[model samples]
Target: MTLHRFKTCATSFLAPFILAGVLAGVLAGLSACSGNEGANYEYDYPTVSSDKFQRQRLEELEGGDETVFGELSIGGPKKRGGAAAGEGFATVNYYLWRATLETLSLGPLESADPFGGVIITDWFTLEEEPGSQYRVTAYILGRQLRTDNIKIALYVRPKGTGKAKMDPHRASAVAEAKLENVILSKARTIRATQFK
Candidate 1:
């Protein structure tokens, strides 16, 4: 029974990793198949468009419905969700990302991950409001500069000298809302100034 349980646990733990490896192998095979145009010693296959009889036959069979206008694409069709083979996957709005950094300049930045769209600020206290300390964390979810795509979290605690139980960092909705407004406003201003 113990051996069986261990087998089950081990299988469950490693199943996801094995599946991921298989997926990566398949994707690599697909990408390798797409770049064959540059391969050396490759045989040139004839398409229907290259042959006179086949092109005329195909046109007659399809009744000219297959005639595609504009530039012909050799690559996969463009669609939403997921990146193509060569395009970089950048989902965060640059305006909101820059604005978050600028708005949180009052506090020392702890960590910023551009690709992950996360910004964490160290705890800081304003000279004007010494009674409270604030820490800010911002998340930019997508490429769009919409209010719903950005989130701000503000933690506040009383400025205490010694370790105090009551002065623990508490999440403040009001502070978060205010910070969100400020960040969005700054992002809009930056977008207007830069894009114009």
Candidate 2:
């Protein structure tokens, strides 16, 4: 009974303030909604003349008619097939370099030079050719992902021999050519995946 009496007295004392707050809120909302949108209004800032740089920028923005990155011209898209801003121009073939590294992963990597496009592998023997340990040195000659721009040299050391030379039987010139072909195939695959 005491709690009920306290709640009733408190609500009665706060009723006038709550009603005034609700009345103020309703009036504010009605006034806001009754804006004079029919009244004409204009920006008061003075117009400024465009300089040469401003005109050039406006022209560039307006002249984006080329369809790029498979997107509409109105929206910005990635520029294809070139170095982006702040990046140095690429001189070596990227796909060829990646493909050579991937194909030579059979052996332990000794050295890899991306700019110079040189890949070398340490002497390692495959399971099929346990008697012959092989080393690979690949050179990407140009900025093209073509077969002629890439070169591969394979050296084989037979079991019990201290020095290593081009393989006589296992990894000969034929094997070198085959290695180049493998790298080329991998490059093509990598290029395909990138496009997709």
Candidate 3:
């Protein structure tokens, strides 16, 4: 074959493979660039407009009565049972959470886990005794607002000029028990009022 014809033949033979390689590379680049954009796309349910959903929720809550918006519903067994069941499933016991907070009001809260039902408080020092501080950890054991459903751990340490370490001997069981009693009492009071 002539040199010009040979060159043209070679070009035509290799063109399709080169074009395929370039197309594959472009597709790979586009996919890498779009990171996780389509991973959470839900095809089953159409997205609701936030403003319209909020307006509908407000109308349901208002229920054509401005004065009764904030009032707790009171009536026969059917009304009370459904509301109570719905509230129970949605979250942990509110009374126990409130009582725990109220009891630990003096201490600085470090971490509160609503899902795991754990509350940790930072070191709290008494005004009269600056040399000592206390830390508390409260655990909400169950959804029911019962005394056994709540647990507390109290740690006491003697404050030095440097970092204070907990002394096991200085820890008072009576003080911890007293605090637990107080929390349980408050929880009981809150539960009573809630049922009424």
Candidate 4:
């Protein structure tokens, strides 16, 4: 084959493959950049400790297992050792979980475990107060629709500019209590809708 004809055929054959590779790289880069954008918030909880009662309650409810709904098959055929039909087993209080997520929608969710009934949010800075940020960890104790079934831990931190260091602080008792009340109220509203 002539050099000119060989060169033309090679360029035509390789063009589509090269374009596909470049497109794939760009798409991968974009996805990676956006995948964990919620994890960008920075904060630390220094003195906060996990609640023993909550942990014990969760263990009891979960039957010491981390899987949701314990061994029950959902939306599919029954499995061995699974809950019987009409048993109505659930991992967490759906009302409380939904309410907590809606209340903390401003923050980026870091982790959520429905079986453990825990929702953790990354530090979120208020637009009006750039120097201050807050993080939240919420626990839905059980399936019961009760006020006491929900628990929350709120953490606040003040960012320092220049040479100053960031210091973490637990939100005030009153503020924490207020947030809990807000979540509970929202839960009630959501639960009410189910009946109507």
Candidate 5:
């Protein structure tokens, strides 16, 4: 009787383990039969193609004209006096159509994050002429978020031909004007659409 009770207790204890092993095998077989080799792949973020963005921007500026040019650049600031090596900032510049580059719309700068990037959503109308080109320089300021009084300047010129012969100050002014014109025009369009 003693032997029989011991055997029964052992069987009960082993029963759960045996059941778990059987379930695991069954699951493995089902997974194999389902043709799932555990080769799941995923991309976390939306893949933003430079070409795609440029094309989209150009299309917006061209009013669906279907003829447009788009270019983009991204890189760090040039090294200056030997403060720290490999510590610099970079910017992504975008130029769409053939509008001249002018102003940068830099967002607020915080002490904790002293420097910020700008996105220039530029819109303008120009007379149809050859070699008419526009450049939009997206300036990026690199600041030390923590230690040291380090600041770096980085810029990327949107892809285009021709040149706007203006000094930095004048270029900024022109850009601001263009931006204003774009905003005003867009607002007018919206108003007209609403009223109509």
Candidate 6:
């Protein structure tokens, strides 16, 4: 083929590819700009308490005293319930701790598997009130709550020197291997009978 004809054909074919590349570059630029705007969107959630409980939770987590095995922390429950059918109503106490991903080498918990990010908690105080700030800790459940992006579920149990007992089922949520109950409350407590 003559040089002129060959050149014409190549230019025509390359035009579309070049145009596509330019279009893609423009789209990527716009996409990045849009994402930056996302940072400007404010989030609204209940304000995290500045109380000692919250402070202690962050302090222990940041102090590097513990490590999470997967998606767990060793503390007490964040949610509470009334007494069970057979058991009398009891007031549950909780203490929380926090840790950073770089420190614990843990990842996001909500992604299919939470236990992947675990932190072994240290004994912190659960203040039921004056003289009642008992020492305790446990495995915590971690999930990226949209606002803070890092939230851990405290699975509390009886700690050193504390006679107060947590429902067996609540304890199992942390101890069991297979996920028997996604909702922590629904799982049958190991029951006082199992302990005996």
Which one is best on TM-score?
A: 1
TM-score of 4: 0.52
Cα lDDT tens digits, model 4, 160-193, are 6543336667888788789889998897787667
Model 2 superposed RMSD (Cα):
12.5
lDDT of 6 by residue, 118-158 (tens): 33333233445332222212233332211222333434445
For all candidates in order, the CA lDDT equals 0.71, 0.71, 0.68, 0.73, 0.37, 0.36
Using TM-score as the measure, name the better of candidate 1 and candidate 3.
Answer: 1
**Clashing residue pairs in candidate 5 (N, C-alpha, C atoms within 3 angstroms):** 99-134, 100-134, 101-135, 102-175, 103-175
Query: TM-scores of all models?
Result: 0.53, 0.51, 0.49, 0.52, 0.22, 0.20
Tens digit of lDDT per residue, candidate 5, span 1-196?
6999999999999999999999999999888787756779877997889999988755443332111111221223334346642243332111211111222232222122112333333322234423332334332232211111121222223334445323222244555445545533443344345324
Give RMSD to native, each candidate.
21.0, 12.5, 13.3, 21.4, 19.2, 19.3
Give the clash count for each candidate.
Answer: 0, 0, 0, 0, 5, 25
Scored by lDDT, the top model is: 4
lDDT of 1 by residue, 156-190 (tens): 87887776524656576787888898898897787
| Candidates in descending TM-score order | 1, 4, 2, 3, 5, 6
Indicate the TM-score of model 2: 0.51
lDDT of 2 by residue, 83-179 (tens): 5521332245667777888899999999987656688999888999788788899988765567786899898788555444454343678889999
Question: Can you write out model 3's per-residue Cα lDDT over 150-192, one digit (the tens) per residue?
Answer: 7778888887655446452336778777887898889778655
Indicate whether candidate 1 or candidate 5 has the larger lDDT: 1
lDDT of 6: 0.36
Better of 2 and 3 by lDDT: 2
* Candidate 3 backbone collisions, by pair: none
